[model samples]
Target: MKPLADRIALVTGASRGIGRAIAVRLAQDGALVGIHYRAERDKAEQTLDDIRAAGGDGFLIAADLADPAGATQLSEALIAELRARRDPPQFDILVNNAGIDDRKTIEQVTEADFDRMLQINFKSPFFLIQKLLPVIADGGRIINISSMASRLSFPTMPVYAPTKAALSTLSRVLAAHLGPRGITVNAVLPGATSTDLNPLSDPARAAAVRDSVALGRIAGPEDIAPVVAFLASKEGGWITGETIEASGGQRL
Candidate 1:
């Protein structure tokens, strides 16, 4: 039997990039994925299509994580979908992968920018977990897609980095809180990955990032998906409250 044959997974920001890769990977592993996107319904549909092409299954969910009530909106939609399918109102994996980075310096960031970053990157995940705790199956997994910026200093991502740091801290705290239930909570930090949000169109910039990595290459979203898949697997049950960096040893 497949390791995740009967599992259900929800991956936020799954319309593209790392989130899309993770969602597709989970589906391939036998989980019925819930692909969440803030906008870009077409992209979300393509993700579902990819899953189907791989002989996997999934559905799309839309919610703007930047909104204060985004978490609630997402949870409600998930429950509704589950009910419509006559499945239990529960899931095995929750991937908090939706986030935004303004790539602004501290001096360039404004109050609005700070608030939006906090709302989407930190606050949304916090409230999403809180709202979905009851329906998250025992022995389930909660994977937060943080960033290496949480550990390394990136002057251009001042506000964005701190939000990811807070998320990593939240993962640690929640792992303990949910340990008694046998649930595993972890944070995945991917470094300098090639995604639309972090484009590397400039050869000089890409080369600079490439030289910093011990792996001597820029990472693709595919490189990070397996790490998350492992963490969501049964074997990953024993691991919790940890931050797994899939950065190819950048700056090491």
Candidate 2:
């Protein structure tokens, strides 16, 4: 049987990029996926189709994580769907992959911009866990998608990294708090990945990032998804409260 057979997974921001890859990977491992998207319903439908093509079952959910009401809407929709299936309204895996980033320096960053990033990147995940804890199955996995920026001190872009740092810290705390319930909370940090959010369009910049990595290449979404899939499996039960970097040995 597959590692996550008979399990249910919900991946936020699953319309594209790393979130989409993780959703597909979890589905491939035999989990019924809830593909959550904010505005890209078409892309989300495509993801669901891909899951079905891979012989997995999945559906789409819409929620703008930046908004508090969106979180409630998603939870209610998820509960209703689970009930329709005659299964308990419980999820076996929750991948907090939805986030936003700002490439602004301290001087350039405005309060609104900072709040927006924090809302989507940090606050959303915080409340998501608060609201979903009861529905999350015991022994379930809570995987937060973090970034290497939390560790690397880039010259500018100050605001984005701290939000990720907050998420990593949250993961550790949740891991400790939820351990008694058999829930494992962890974070995955990816570096210089080839995603829409972090494009490699500039040849010079791309080559510089590539040279910094031991693997000598930018990681694709495919490279990061399997690590998350592993974390959601039985083998990763003992691993919690850790931030695992799947960064192709970048900045090591």
Candidate 3:
């Protein structure tokens, strides 16, 4: 049987990039996926189509993580969708993969920028997990898509890095809190992935990033998705409260 067969997964920001890759990978492992998008309805549909094309099952859900009410609404909507299909209103995997990238230097930061970063990157996940706790199945998995920036300093990403650091800390805390229930929570840090969020189209820029990685190349979403898939599988049950760096051994 497939590892994730008869399972359910919800991947936030699944409309494109890393989230899309993770959602597709989970579906390939036989989990029914909830592809959540903030505003890109078309992209979400495309992701759903890809899942279907791969003979996997899934649906699209829209929610803006930046909004305080977003996570609750998303939970409600997800429950409704599951019920419509005669499935349980609970899920086995929750991938908190939605976040915004900030590239402003310390001198360029503002109160509004800081608030927006925290609201979407950290606050949303906290409340989303809180509100969705009842619906998350026991022995489930929670994967937070963090960044290598949290551990490595960047000149223009002072505020953004902290948010990822906060996420990693949350993963450890939740893993401990949920350990009694057999759930595993972990943070995944990908370094300089080639995605729309951080395109490496420029040869010089791409080469610069490649030179920093031990793998001699910047990673793509495909390189990161399988790691998350492993975490969602039964094989990953024994691992928790850890930060798994899928950064091609960058800076190590």
TM-score of each: 0.98, 0.98, 0.97
Worst 10 residues of 1 by lDDT: 80-89
What is the Cα-based lDDT of residue 235 in candidate 2? 96
Relative to the true structure, candidate 3 reaches a TM of 0.97
Q: Tens digits of per-residue lDDT for model 2 on 141-242? A: 999999999999986758889999999999999999999999999999988888887889899999999999998999999999999999999999999999
**Higher-ranked by TM-score: 1 or 2:** 1
Which parts of model 2 have CA positions greater than 4 angstroms off? none
Better of 1 and 3 by lDDT: 1
Query: Backbone clashes per model, in order?
Result: 0, 0, 0
Model 3 residue runs over 4 Å out of place are 86-88
Candidate 3 per-residue C-alpha lDDT over 1-252 given as tens digits, one digit per residue, 9 for 90 to 100: 889999999999999999999999999999999999999899999999999999998998988888888888888888888777644667889999999977999999999999999989999988889888888889999999999999998999888899999999999999999999898999999898998878899999899889989989999999999999999998898899999999998877
Model 3 C-alpha RMSD to native: 1.1
User: What is the full ranking by TM-score, best candidate first?
Assistant: 1, 2, 3
Error of 3 at 30 (Å): 0.2
